[model samples]
Target: MDQDSQLLQAATDFAYYPGSHSDDSATEFLNRFPLPLIINALQTQFDVPGLESALVACLERLFKTKLGASLIPEYMPFVQVGLQADSQAVRSLACKTVSCLLENLDNSHKVAAHLIKEFNMYPLLLDCLINGNEEVAAGAIDAIKKLASCPEGIDIIFPSNKGGDTDLGIIASQCSSLGRVRVLALVVKLFSVSTSAASAICSLNLLKLLEAEIRSADDTLVTLSVFELLYELAEVEHGTEFLSKTSLFQLLSSIISNNFTDSILRSRAMMISGRLLSKESTYSFIDEQCAKSVISSIDGRLQSLDTSDRDEFETALESLGQIGLSIRGATLLLSGSSPAARHVIDAAFDQQGPERHGRQLAALHALGNISGETRSENDIILDAEAEENLLRLLYEAASKSSKLTPSGLFLSVLQQDSEIRIAEWEL
Candidate 1:
């Protein structure tokens, strides 16, 4: 066999070898075909059609074991070269290797610092983020997040000074809209790492970059992308405080209230708005006026949705549940002149077809959420009419819908509140 064929066979052996066994089979295997040998072959034999792919697969499997992961730092030079290789697959693999390397370390800060200050790989990672393909870009994002976990690393990723040589804002300015979106997503990830990381992100005013993208409204696809990122940010613990500092709450409410906005964008905006208010801890971040505006906008949306708009209808219902997660938000839903609460009840009892059944499921979930299915006793403050609606939902959902049942839905809610329990028994 030629050298390339020989290396391919060796890589296949490495990929298939079970490294998790007690016998240290990976170590035994490496004794015969060391990582250095494979790295040397990869450096010189990259031109060989299948060698790079096989070696990369072998490396990925090896990364699953402690012994295999411990050996990667010595091979950083090959990784650096792979990141700059002409082939997309190789660059993506390089990024994955960096992630694996960081994920496995006990003192990752040391390696992270070396990668940035000594190995000079940070720029190459950024290059992959900006110019790589989808897989490569995802891997780069993951690696950058892993690097950002440590205080020193996060400082490097988001420096104190704005518009510095390494500022992500500057990097994003050089990216296409899609690339900028990717960077925005990276910022969210970094923000979730620690409080210090979040402080770093806020201090540099990186969120304004995302806000600028959303307000530009020039590209529907790009705007949607930023909204999705905002949704992710909203999901992070304490992320709402970071978001509340910006005008994002008002911006999202505007997108939701605007009849001219794209339906899909409006739907996403409503869901994001709901998420911002869902957590009781974060509920106070949004002022009363803004929250009321959101409820009104979503009510208008639900009223506008017909049978043909099932997806939007379901989305709006789900968003309502998110909004009504808190007692205050649910109070707005139940007290408003808008028929939003009635609409939720009607949708829950609407058992027409498979499509309506789907909406029915979402509406049922929304109803349970709105009625304090998961709140503390002191927090579960449902009024008489609202209590009547919950009881009605239990009764009607059982008898009215042959295709579904609300027994499982109400069981938990029934357990939480004595009044509802008594009402349920009295019926």
Candidate 2:
């Protein structure tokens, strides 16, 4: 047989049983044919109905070897073309191949740069992610994850608004096509690109698209995935601040605090709250009703000692701490007969992981900020016991630790001297 026929047969055999092939045949195939020709043959073979999976398997196997890794660039054109192919199988095969190339190659930065600068493949990747088969869609998502990793690649995956690209907008409009898992993966992959990407995502109004899916989904993985995406988005300085302004924040807060929400999902929501509360300006934006719902969630989780959801519990404490950072929030939590202050106090003393320590510090900062609030003469937010509980917890924390480390913060010797004020919180 000629070299071309020999190469195709060998690949077919290897694809069906990677273990059946030896390095000898794979080496001979590469030695006889140029990378472009081999990639072309494989790309064309994807049209064969039953051979698609096997050919992809062969492509994956070839990419694992040194020769295959070096020739990744040769497959670039084929992949870009295949991404837009009318055949679902061809599109899926191309996506899987790109994922494999990115995974096996050491110089992915170069590969990614080639794909974006030379190939301009982001739209194709986005298209596959939106419309490809499940496994193929996942492969597209993986390619996106790689593209979002490097500076140049990140710029390509999440272009500035001037690019005249509307793929994200299309994804938002067609969100009903995305299930919860894909939705979570897409959001995470997009935000990881950059803070600027976060801004672009905000423009998409992505949360509105997924709102119903998040509310109605019953799977734990789905629930957890959605909330985690919310946390990731909220962590961004640009995205969640805008998101918080919309009723979306309140809706998520209510859903998360609901009794039926999974523990992990609830924790994810609490994380979003904590991130928003991280900023004093954003802290003020959380309205009273939203804060009340947040408080109720914290109280419910704190009371659930029967279920040792420590991570969720810690998250609740952190959210409550953020709420406490605001005067309005602190007053609500530390108000007369409110269990909020007591729960915050107990969380501060729990002595769990370093994570717990961070949560405690957040709670303490909220308390300190609350204690410093000078009520109007007619203000009645804090009664006698509330003041006493607030003072007592502060003094206890002050007496116990020589220094405070509240999630990257360090109180100075001067600030340490302020510990005496903990005892002075008498109303």
Deviation in angstroms for 376 in model 2?
35
Candidate 2 lDDT over residue span 90-206, tens digit each:
787677667666655566576557655687677787778777778768778877776666677656755666435534544554565354457556876676556655555667565
User: How would you encode candidate 1's per-residue C-alpha lDDT over 225-306 as one tens digit per residue?
Assistant: 8988888888999787778788887788788778788889988988898898788776667677877777888888788778
Runs of candidate 1 exceeding 4 Å displacement: 1-3, 18-23, 106-108, 305-308, 336-339, 349-361, 383-427
Residue 425 C-alpha lDDT in model 1? 41
> TM-score for all predictions?
0.83, 0.55
Residue clash pairs of candidate 1: none
lDDT of 1 at 20: 44
Candidate 2 TM-score, C-alpha based:
0.55
lDDT of 2 at 121: 75
The lDDT leader among the candidates is 1
Q: Distance (Å) between predicted and true CA of 4, model 2?
A: 9.4
